[model samples]
Target: MMLIVTGYMYVEPSSITEFVEDLQKLAITARQRDGNLSYDAAMDDPHAGRLLIAERWRDQAALTAHLHSSDTVAFVGRWGDAMRGEILKYDARRERGLMDE
Candidate 1:
């Protein structure tokens, strides 16, 4: 089974640049983790201080391991009221490309 995570987070506008730098680091590390299919983070709206998050994992075990990974903790720990987010996860059932024939 595959797992997908998606959400948005708001960071202090002043921290956007640093946040992006840190996020890029996290993304690079996460992509190398076991069972990680894909991971990405990007600014959804800089003016609104909103950033989008998307992740795909091979399975629940993979996602769970990642949740407890040191990189994850460090990234999260950096958020001391400097960030607020709403995230959701799902177990993919059927999915298809919008452009698939």
Candidate 2:
């Protein structure tokens, strides 16, 4: 099954710019990884210090591999202290066309 992960990061106001730069680099690397379907990050409009990330993977195995990737590990170790966040993941089971319903 495909996996979809989404979340928000609450960063220190002073660190927001740096966080964004790092996140962009991470996203680029993630997109080039095997089984990575998509990776994106955006600043929340109503929240000054909040950034949102959404990712899609081919399957649980792919997601697991991503979690263990060196880039991912380094990113966490490097910027973990600059932000706080939660991630939620879901398995996609079915899809239907709008006209089907």
Each candidate structure's TM-score, on Cα atoms with residue i matched to residue i, is 0.90, 0.89
Candidate 2 off by > 4 Å: 45-47, 96-100
Worst 10 residues of 1 by lDDT: 78-87
Candidate 2 on 1-101: residue-level lDDT in tens?
88999998888887888888988998999999899999998889424688788999999988899899999999999988877888799988775687886
lDDT of 2: 0.86
Note the Cα lDDT for every prediction shown.
0.89, 0.86
Point out the worst 10-residue segment of candidate 2 by lDDT.
44-53
The C-alpha stretches of model 1 lying farther than 4 A from their native spots are 99-101
lDDT of 1 by residue, 1-101 (tens): 89999999899888899999998998898999999999988889998889999999999999989889998898889875689989899999777898975
Q: What lDDT does candidate 2 reach at residue 2? A: 85
